[model samples]
Target chain A: MNSIHDMGGMHGFGRVEREVNEPVFHAPWEGRVMALYRALGFLQFWTIDGGRAAIESLPPQTYLTASYYARWLMGLERSLARSGIVGADEIAAGRSLRPARSHPHIMTASDVANLQRGNFERPTASPARFKPGERVRTLNLNPETHTRLPRYARDKEGLVEAVHGCHVFPDTAAIGAGENPQWLYTVVFTGRQLWGADADPTLSVSIEAFEPYLAPV
Target chain B: MGDDHKHDHEHPDHSQLGEMQARVRALESILTEKGYVDRSTLDLIVDTYETKVGPRNGARIVARSWTDPEFKARLLSDATAAANSLGFPNPVGAHLIAVENTPQTHNLVVCTLCSCYPWEVLGLPPVWYKSAPYRSRAVIEPRAVLAEFGVELPENTRIRVWDSTAETRFLVLPMRPPGTEGWSEQRLADLVTRDSMIGAGLVRGP
Candidate 1:
């Protein structure tokens, strides 16, 4: 989805403020929210991609107005509601109305180590469709759903620098779709290519792109 | 660096307990009461990133790379192994890639979709890194963004913006300062700022 979260190029948000000696979290609640978010991710309630999709699902006004952890909180609620772990009413009501349903895949403290070593890389039967140095153009698509392809790079031509091994496709996996592992590539584009001739000519940008989003130019 | 001096800031002291904070506390209390989340475990998770793991881990790696040529070679080639060799464990979904800043080119990292940082090394991301302005402007006008951060490069230097779109996370091996040739690793590590590793600032001279 071409949501506001994909704010790659559009401007006028004002100056970037830096906090001196910033802590891991701003507020105590922020930490708790983060911990809960991580806990949800650990339980595999939703893929990281799906979580991102949930955040992007926020309406423009809410997205711009909410704090960082607020987005995380909202996204977590969206995923939990979609997964039937808890509903919006229960969330606002501050307690479960009925007995909790059992989930087989609960993650506990003992599983933290195993979770750390887990890898997202998966094997693929099909060979890569693109190689290094091949010129390609990003497929321009604006689906109203989860996607990893950024809006700025869509339809822009770039050179494949390297073909990363097959990995789970996030666009589909985010929404309860299968892993759908596909070829990933590091594509390099001049800033001019992505922006315009007025952009810094010497500047270049590289992005990791899924095979489905690219085509040989 | 001048910009930083001009932008005199205090530590992120979130002292004022706003309505948002109250709501968050309420949510936490509810989740804890529900048995869905354990408060102690939650604190442990947060503490791991807040105190135990953070930019200091990345600073150690950056310091080593600056002093050791072989480690630098290994880091630029295969960052994961190089990092693990220095006791930097791989985070669950991270694949580290070190992009060195050279005389002619500069590198910066941003996740346009989400704040996908190398948590094992750099800990949780800063607030601005995840904000809309940084995410949008970092790719579009990196020079201006860097300027706002007080990082000014020569006109001829080209900026290479790396958008972390997938699992492959990147860390910028900022150039070793000119006068720090014989500095010890610990001394060098002290000079390594979090923003330098993120390509938003330079290592200050001793």
Candidate 2:
């Protein structure tokens, strides 16, 4: 989706302010929200890609105004409500309306360490379609739903730098379209190719593109 | 509106903050009551990232690479295994690739689509790294962004920005500062800041 969150090339947001000594969470609520967001992942209601897409799907106004964790809280709420785990009134009234639905054994203390660190790669029987040093072009896609393809690199020509093994594709997985695993490649696009004549000739940008997004140039 | 009424206008700000805090508290309690989350375990995870695990892990790796040629070779060639060899397993989606910053080339990293950082190695990302400004401008004007972070490269040096569109996270192996030939790993690690490894800043002179 071409949302506000696809902030690859647009500008004028101002300087990157550096804090002298930054804490992990600026406020106590930030910590709680972060924990809730992570804890919700244990339910397997949505993929990590889904969580991100929810955040990206926020209204442009909310995306611009909300704090970092506020965005996380919103995404969590969205996932919960959409999945039927929690109702809208329950969230608004600050209480669960009914007995908790039976879930995959509620993640225990012992399970916290290994959560989300498991292998996301899905085995593929086919060999890679493109090899290193091969020229390829990114598909110019503009979808209305969740997509990992940033707007900046759409339709750009690049060289395959390296081929990573097949992994769960986020473009489909985020929207409940299945893993749709595909070969991933590190494609190198010159700055000029991406940004045009004003860009430095020697500079380059490498993007990890899914197989479906690329084609022989 | 009078001078003495300025405080009245600020009252809503405090109430708004209080409401947000109440909302977060409410959500936490509901999740706890439903058995979806354990408060203590959640605290444990947050505390681990807050205090125990951080850029220090990545710093040590960078310092070791700076001092050991064999380790550096492994780091550049195969970073995931190199990280594992040093007791730092590549976590989850983080298939790290260490890009060396030479006198001629510089490297910068950004996840334009999302904030996909190497959490196991570099720990939780900083607020700025996850900010809208950094995400938008890092790829569009990396030199300008780096300049704001106080990193200024020569005009002739090429800047390579790695947009982490997938699981392969990048770590910038910033060039060793001049006059640090025999520095111990411990001392070398001190010079490597979190930003240096992220390619936003350079290692300061010791």
Candidate 3:
């Protein structure tokens, strides 16, 4: 879905501010929110892609105004309610009203010690259609469902810098379709190609695009 | 309004912070009540990131790459295996790619669609990294963005912005600064800041 979160090349955001000696998190709650997000993942409540989709699906206004972890909190609530793990009324009441739903796994101290980062790579279904140094063009796509292709790079031509093997396609994974792994490539585009005549010539952009999002130029 | 007088003038975000605190606490309680989450597990997760893992891990890798050409070659060719050889495995199925910065070229990393970072190496991303300004402009006007970060490059040097839109994560291997000959890897590692690895800033000379 085309949302404010796909903020590549669009302007009007103010100057970047760097906080000196910034802590890992600002507040205690922020750490808890981060932990909750990871813990939820440990329990296999939702795929990482699904969590990202939930955050992207937020209304543009809320999406823009919410802080980083605040967005996480909102997405968690949305995912939980959507999956029927917790009811909307229960969230509103600030407590669980129904009996606990049995889950195949629950996060424990041992699980926390053994937590590992999710690997989306899968066995390739077929050989890669494109190769390094090959010219390719990104397909212009705007699906209502989850997609990794940013709006700015749509329909742009690029050179394949590297073929990153097969990985889970988020478009299918986010909607519960399946892993649907595709050949992923690192495609490089000149700044002029992406941003037009005013772009600085020294700039180049490379995006990791799945094969489904690209075609022969 | 009666409550207006109670507002803390110095800390304007006090109320908003309270609201956020309540919301997160409520959600944790709900999850715990449903037996989905353990409070101890949450504490452990937070503690792990807070103290155990961070950019020091990446700094060590960068410093080693600076001193050891073979390790650098392996890191460039197969970053995942190289990092794992040093006990720094990337999260599950994700691949790690190390883009080196040369005198004629530079590398920057961003996630335009969402905040995808090499957490196992560089830890969680900074606030500006996930902000709209950096994500929106880094690809189009990288020189200007680097200028804001005090990294003014020569006009002839090329800038490459890597938008991590897939499962692959990037780490910018900043060029080693000069005048630090015979320096120990520990000393070099101390000079490797997190910002330099993200391509937002350059490593300064000793």
Candidate 4:
């Protein structure tokens, strides 16, 4: 997430400041659509036990109605099974573990931005923002929230990295009071920088940091 | 909104997106039978979303990450707003997250819970991304899984796997590979493959 392009323009990354933005209102509906799609996706997990075990695990009659995802899963399995990604014996034995990040379709950057700007409160523009090459530090607080400083990002201080303009505060999102942030940034931290001693000396990593999430070093 | 669908008994969801599409299609069919809504123009919106808008969106994101540090900074903050900040229009999500990758730990994203992704920047995720193997294994044993993809990190590299819940989504800023100095933003954008930005894989050196 180093640059704006990576987020799918202004509308998609869940941020938008229009006075009457549409997503904030329709998000829940979309959330439902998303839920249905996800339910379809989750059934893939049970496919491991093969169709029978999965069907058996569900309520007696639920199988008739709840069979959509499992069927999709089985089809995928059968297709892969023939290719030897998983053999037919595995299907019969119900022991098929496939590769990671391998599925049927992916959401693109634009897809994400389409969800932006439904009901989030916009942050007032603030001139105080970080810039590339400035020094900064991650915050120490950890509440149940949308925090930019991961457990890993915490306790480690690095350069200001890149001040990525602005955005709605994720803290807002966590509290159901999501306010769009006004600016964004990317901070470069060496793996050695984040994890001292054990960190790979030659390896360096950059972290995307939001304005409210950082302070001057 | 009423006649676009012919009411296919199969794939009910295709008809679920309001009757407008179905109605439009129905009208198109009638028009075509009676000579109206030319075949080329009939799928205007559909074609635009698939071919014109989708890839163009990809080009914008790929181009920006390579050229401007300032823009990159804005992106890292509020992913959605950053695009708007730089003048791009509506993207998909209500929330955006930017995950950074470093030498010691590579950042990859997965929605173990769902298909939460930052589509605006990364374009479409490949088919395999939504698979259970990537989501479940990535959080549990990311090192081994990444290895299969040929991205074998050293044992010491602490893999911090993110399981994106429905509320939060993620995008990755892959490290710019070496030896690509003096390249244009378009050139740099070419390296921004779907997986690398998602943390499932990295864009390799040219």
Candidate 5:
């Protein structure tokens, strides 16, 4: 999905606004929204990729206008309705009208205390196709489903700086497909290659490209 | 157009803020009623990010790297393991990669696709980090972005922009400022600002 969310190199946006002494959460509800997002992870209703995809699926207007957490709130609603955990009508009415669905896991205070990040690395029998210092070109892919390949890096040539081993492929993991693990690499592209000859000579861009997104140049 | 300054905040409109509050409240109540999430757990999650986990964790890591050569090597070699050794684990399905700033090169981190940050170490990302301007221009015009953040590197210094497009997260290890040779690790940690670690600003000399 080449949505507004894939904003890397597109212009017309103004200068970056830096807030002084910014609070973690602007409002109490902001904190609550974040908490809900974290807590719902225990349910395993959606993958992290799926959650991101939901946010990306937002209308371009809504995606551009909504705040960060507000986007999360909207994405949460979208996921909840899609998963049948909650319905749009129930959300609009501010109450639960349907019978509560049972989840295998419900986050408790104890679960919160012992929370740790999920590890995505998996064992693979196949060797990596590309090695460090190898020249590769990113595939020009424009999939409608969730994809980690940003529009800016599509069809760009880069050098593999490091091999990140086998990890869950987001393109599959995002859309309820299995975690088709792929070898990830740190591909470095010159600013001139990504943008144009007018780009700064002193600048370079590196992205983590899954093996599927790359081919030997 | 006149209300451009309002773009500084995530939620600028009062009505929109109120609507978000109500929507979040409604969602929370529904989830609780459905027995999917407990209120106490939600409270604990918020408290953890608010009080415990944050840039202080990353700051300690940076300060340790500055003081301890062996630890710095480990951080540069295997950042995920080094972060976990300091009790700052990477977020779900993510790896931590610490890029060092030197006399000739600088590193900046961004997720142009989404706001994929190392939450365990840095906590939630700031609003500007997830903003469109920073996301769109950070990779293409990093020197300009750095200038906005008051970080003007020498013209000869190379800028390496890490767009965290996968499960990898980047932390910029700013060069230790001079004139603080004998400073305590704690004192050095005090100089590690979030912006410096994000490569948007330089660690100021005391």
Candidate 6:
């Protein structure tokens, strides 16, 4: 249990607190690469116009397949070709491809960072905070947007026996919400605490939690 | 490396994406039918990572620390081994250091590096966690960031920021929320939020 909570407290590369005005940290080519990838991928998690604009803004590159989205598409095309299934080129040649059918590009590390950093904006403050040792309940539902609680962790309860300092809310960042939420918490729960017969009586699983996902039990 | 995803058609119809998804879906369906990828197993993977992994892991650890002092000491000393005892796997040689989120101080997490996370316990990290701004800015201006999320800390509370990297990770032992006295562990897991585990949020009131 301690180990799991400790996992949440992960911090390395801790020394560089603020970005320096160094060229190495960010380069113009980096932005161009991002734009090229976005164009090739047809970015998702964004509106259609936004996606179009991103693609149009891309810097020139000789090959589309080299870009992130194009690479993924290349995989799909191969799968279709191998399966002896319907082909994308036929549809494209016919000019009958639907916008809704397009899959958004799988965001790369750099692209994910760029999108979250520039576009997202957060609210002024947190709506609530649980105190140390207070009781709380985690929500069971799943929202496609960003959330900290995984499906396996749901409906399991633990004591908010300890509080870690605040960090950015993952949900906000996931949906271009920018940084949100301040504190992350560790709740103590036993194995029998979650699965009765399936779990070892003496064994347990500790979970790291965020505030918004939890409610008083 | 490959360019087969595109269709080389005789006419300029331009309906490539629709055909692409349909083809992909068809392949997925075939794989599921052929038993290459078990549907239930994939669903379970998605389910476990999305839910069962986060705050519950944190809570159990905190309980152990509060109840068993020796185990707590061992956990503090060598986190990976301590976690492995509970059937957790550590691939990154992740050395964990647990920070007790107490009334006076709160411990938080961010990856100043790539989105290094404790997947053994927390499962795959949420998409937001892997972002650059969250990784880069989390350590520098934690207070303002917290405020934006609706969590405003008392100025006196000491803020301990954890930087997640490939070599090490951190988890928060959230201070319990108030209300019920005798709720079972299963009941408690209900309140453990992914945010709480990272030190961004406290369990909300029911």
Docking class for candidate 4? incorrect
Q: Report the alpha-carbon TM-score of model 6 versus the true structure.
A: 0.40
> lDDT by residue for model 6 over A1-217, one digit each (tens)?
1111112223332222122222210222222322332332333334322232232223323122232333333433343333333246532343222223334343344332222112221333654478778777667756544354544456767667555555556556544555654566766555455556654343333455777667788
- The better candidate by lDDT, 3 or 6, is 3
Task: Enumerate the candidates' DockQ scores in order.
Answer: 0.47, 0.46, 0.52, 0.06, 0.67, 0.03
What's the DockQ of model 6?
A: 0.03
Name model 6 segments beyond 4 Å from true: A1-217, B1-55, B63-71, B87-94, B178-187, B204-206
Task: Flag the better candidate by lDDT, 1 or 5.
Answer: 5
**Which residue pairs show collisions in model 3?**
A117-B92, A118-B92, A118-B93, A119-B92, A119-B93, A120-B93
lDDT per residue as tens, model 2, B2-64: 212322322236666687789989888887888888889788667766776679888988999
Off by over 4 Å in 4: A1-217, B1-49, B52-59, B85-89
Tens-place lDDT per residue, model 3, A36-93, is 9998877676788999999999999888777788888899999999888888899899
lDDT of 2 by residue, A82-178 (tens): 8887877899989988778777776666665554354566788799999999999999999988877788999999999998899889889899999
Kindly list the per-residue Cα lDDT of model 5 for residues A72-97, writing each as its tens digit.
Answer: 98999999899999999999889999
Output the worst ten-in-a-row residue range by lDDT, candidate 1 chain A: A109-118
RMSD of each: 3.6, 4.0, 3.7, 17.5, 1.8, 21.4
- Chain A vs native chain A, TM-score per candidate: 0.95, 0.96, 0.97, 0.44, 0.97, 0.43
Residue-pair clashes, model 2: 0
The CAPRI-style docking tier of model 5 reads: medium
Most accurate candidate by lDDT: 5
Ten contiguous residues minimizing lDDT sum, candidate 2 chain A? A111-120
Ranked by TM-score, the better of candidates 4 and 5 is 5
For TM-score, the strongest prediction is 5
Clashing residue pairs, candidate 1?
none
Docking band of candidate 3: medium
- Model 6 per-residue lDDT at A57: 26
Q: For candidate 3, what's the TM-score of chain A, rounded to 2 decimals?
A: 0.97
Q: Which residue segments of model 2 deviate by more than 4 Å?
A: A113-116, B1-13, B88-94
**Native contacts retained, all candidates in order:** 0.57, 0.62, 0.75, 0.05, 0.81, 0.00
Query: Which candidate would rank higher by DockQ, 2 or 3?
Result: 3
